[model samples]
Target: MSIEVNNESGYAVDEAEFAALARHVLDAMHVHPQTDLAIMLVGTDVMSELHVQWMDEPGPTDVLSFPMDELRPGRPGDVTPAGLLGDVVLCPEVAARQARDAGHSTAEELLLLTTHGILHLLGYDHAEPEEEKEMFALQRQLLLTFLATR
Candidate 1:
């Protein structure tokens, strides 16, 4: 698997840890070894621009996922072909604020968001109540397990 992280947000963050987290998430999800993923950290201004351009939202959000090839997890007996998993853009400044509210470290918040983005890339969504429950539950489980083995 290819997991690349680029931090241009001007905020110092643990880029290696996120790369490891992405690897862990992809390993758990059983993504193909040839799969590729990009995690970019941008400032709030760029994130806001992306939010408006892609999502038509107002301001910068926590995280956004852009999927390529729409690669879903393969069935138990099927093999998943190699493909680009797309990019997950994040804003560390926004995450820090959310971290304060959630009473966790910034790294922890980023980990949660990273998992959330990976799920989205894997074709998981939370547009409905049931979907929200399922997506959030899986996100929580993945984060907990990943952190435990740290």
Candidate 2:
């Protein structure tokens, strides 16, 4: 997979760990090895612009996903096609604040956001209560599995 993590946020985020997480998640999800993905870490200013432009929201959020080819996970035994998975934009500044609120480290907060972003890229959403449960459960499971190997 062509998973690339770019830390343009100017923070000293661990890029390699994120790349590895992406690889692990995509692989477990059965995404093709030729698939392309980009993870972008940006400051609050850039994230706020994206939030307004894409979501019409007021300020920077934790994460945002912009899917390219609209790739979806294939059924078991089915061959997943290869394509561009798209971008997951993250804000470490917001994550740090959320971390404080959650009583966790900034790194853990970012991992959760990144996992959430990946699920969104794979056509997951939490607009409804049921959807929220399923999406969040899957996100938590994926994160736990990824962390276990670290």
Candidate 3:
């Protein structure tokens, strides 16, 4: 997988960790080895613009996903085809505030957001109750398993 992380948020973050976490998630989901992904960390202003432009939301959100290939998770014996997975845009400022409310570090919140965004790229959504439950459960499971390796 080719995972690129671009930090334009002007905030100090572990870019390598983001790439590693993305790799872990993609590998666990059995995505093809040649798959490509991009993670962008941007400021509130840019995030706000993107939020309104893409999601039609009013303010800066924590993370946003723009999927390119619309790939789904693959089974143990079947890996996803090689393609551009998507771009996951993150706002550190928003994540920090949410982290304070959630009583965790900004890094942890970002990691969770990264996982959530990747799930969205993998065609998982939470617009409905059951979808939310399934998506959140898988998100928790993937995050916990990744954390265990640290």
Candidate 2 lDDT, 1-150, residue by residue in tens: 898999999888888999999988888788888999999999999999999999999899999999999998766566369999999999999999999999999999999999899989999999999999999999999999999999
RMSD of 2: 0.9
lDDT of 3 by residue, 14-48 (tens): 99999999999999999998999999999999999
Angstrom error of the Cα, residue 85, model 2: value is 0.5
lDDT per residue as tens, model 1, 1-150 = 889999999989888889988988787777787899999999999999999999999899999999997888765456368999999999999999999999998889988999999899999999999999999998999899888988
Estimate candidate 1's alpha-carbon lDDT, on a 0 to 1 scale: 0.91
Model 1 clashing residue pairs (backbone): none
Instruction: Give the TM-score ranking, best first.
Output: 3, 2, 1
Question: What is the C-alpha local distance difference test score of each model?
Answer: 0.91, 0.92, 0.96
Where does candidate 3 stray beyond 4 Å?
none
Shift in Å, residue 116, candidate 2: 0.4
Task: Give Cα distance to truth, residue 67, candidate 2, Å.
Answer: 0.5
Each model's TM-score? 0.95, 0.97, 0.98
Best by lDDT: 3
What range of 10 consecutive residues in model 3 has the weakest lDDT sum? 141-150
Location of the lowest summed lDDT over 10 successive residues in candidate 1: 71-80
- Candidate with top TM-score is 3
